[model samples]
Target: MNSITVLGSGWLGFPLAQLLSKEFSIKLSTTSSSKFENLKDENIIPFIVDINNLNGDIDKFLSSDILIINIPSKNIDGFKELIKHILNSNIKKIVFISSISVLKDETTPLLEIENLFKKTNLEITILRFAGLIGYGRNPAKFFPNGKVVKDADTPVNMIHRDDCINIIQKVVKQDIFNETFNCVAPSHPTKKEFYTYCAKVSGLPVPTFDSSKNESNKKTVKSDLLVSKLNYTFIHEDLMKIVF
Candidate 1:
């Protein structure tokens, strides 16, 4: 069996590691030793990887057939360092789980990062994901207690944890490489609509916002290529309806 190493096993990696266990020799790395037992009980090899500062030497770890990077870092400079180290490895395929936030009000960063991966010799699949909701890290936490945006009608994008794992699995099986895909559900609920749903279920008051005053513009990433290229299906189509 091929080996798969997940760099992080927090809210997202927890489920991903579990899913990969059946098919691959899975190793999960985390900054916290407290979750070590949880990883061990799941029959996964766990490591304490302090890569948050982008200092994790991944050379030895890249011996695996597949590497799934799921760490959280908004600084492109840090990510650039990690990639600089990783691109030199003998690993054949790498899946970088990036965020749609990379696309939020900033094109240059994603563009530069995408260019770095695209221009590399390694087969890189960059998955720009939407707001991850469901389970521990819920979206409701951000828009808490009577919070509202002026452009409440602005489109809100979200994806469930299951869909994220499913998409990654499909790519692994298909050997899809050197491509970037969006991993978001098709639902484009307005900010008001989404917050209202959250408020109702999360017991928070949904405050009013003059949506016309909202000037923020962002396009929710679609999974069309993901569906066509990898033959993947989303567990949650209308993500907004499913999050709460």
Candidate 2:
């Protein structure tokens, strides 16, 4: 069986590792030791890894056939150090979990970190995800209580957590690497329409947005490349159908 090491087994990482465990040997990492037994219960090899002050045996983590990096950090300098360390590893295939926020703003700090990998020869697959919603995360919480959220007419670009895992699984199985793909739902709903509905369902104060705002310059992120290239179907294509 192919061995896969998942760095940063948190929200998305934990479920992802669980799903992939049936098909591949799983190695999961956490910053806290408290989560070790939980990971172990799932039949996953658990390790304590702190990228900020990495003191663990990195060689053992990179010993797998592939590495899926799900850690989130804004410290560019610290990421540069991690990049340098990873470049020295024997691991060749890497699946980097990034966000689509980099698309709207190229100056996003994560983009700077991602660029460092572009300089390397490793097979890198960068997944730029949209606003992640599912499970513990609810978009209603972001709108706050009766606060005016700008871009009311601007279409919301969001992706479900299930889709995120499915895309990664497809990427690994198909051997697709060295590319950046926007991972989001195809349908785009205006913020006012989407959030108002979300607030009602969650019993939160509905957010207000200017109805007169012009949406001519608004850009809806296109996430068709992955579906087109990999022929993978999104489980939650319509955000309205999602149950919180």
Candidate 3:
């Protein structure tokens, strides 16, 4: 059996471990002690680890064939030490769960971290995910009644949490390494239409968007590379189905 160590076990990582545990031996970590029992009960070897302040035998957490970096952190001060530790370990492959925010015109700290990983010739796969939505993370709650937002006509790039997990699994199983995958739903729903439907379905007040905003300001992330490269299909491609 293949052993995989997931560095962070939060909203996306916890469910990901649950789904992959059936086949692969999952060694999961969390920053919270309260989650240990639940993870252990699910047959996951749980460890309390904080990436920002890493302590204990780092080897114990990384003693696996593969490592999945799921922690979302803006601090990269200790990141070099973390990289050194991973390089010293026997673990060879890495799957870094990144956000699409790095693509924005502004320079982001995550991009710097990613560039550092690219500099090292390690077998790493960077999965840049779009706005994540599913279960408790409904987009309807973000905009309140009579709230005015900008860039209403821009395309919304989003993916269901389930799809994110599925895409990660596919990348691991296929041994896809040293590549970047934009993990997003194929549907390109305009912000106005999508959020309007969300508010209507959830009985929330519909928010208005400024139509005068420049179209160039809006950003749309494409996952054509992910689809073609991974040969994967999205389960929830339409935002309409997502709202209902």
Best by TM-score: 3
- After superposing candidate 3, which stretches have Cα over 4 Å from the reference? 40-42
Clashes of each: 3, 0, 0
Task: Write the residue-wise lDDT of candidate 1 on 1-244 in tens digits.
Answer: 3788788888888788888888787878877789876444455777777654644446665557778888775456766776777767656678888877766656656556666666767888999888888887656667555555667777887888888888888788788878888878888887777767876777766666666754556465677988888877678887456646
List lDDT for all candidates, in order. Answer: 0.75, 0.85, 0.85
TM-score of each: 0.86, 0.93, 0.94
Candidate 1: clashing pairs of residues = 150-210, 150-211, 151-211
Candidate 1: 10-residue stretch with minimal lDDT: 51-60
Instruction: Give the CA lDDT, 0 to 100, for residue 20 in model 1.
Output: 85
TM-score of 3: 0.94
Candidate 2 lDDT, 1-244, residue by residue in tens: 3889899888899999999998998888888888865444455888888778776576677678788999987777766776676777767888999998887678888898788878888899999999999898999888665678887888889999999999999999999999899999988898988888888888888887876766563778988789888997889999887888
Off by over 4 Å in 1: 41-43, 52-57, 75-81, 84-88, 107-111, 215-220
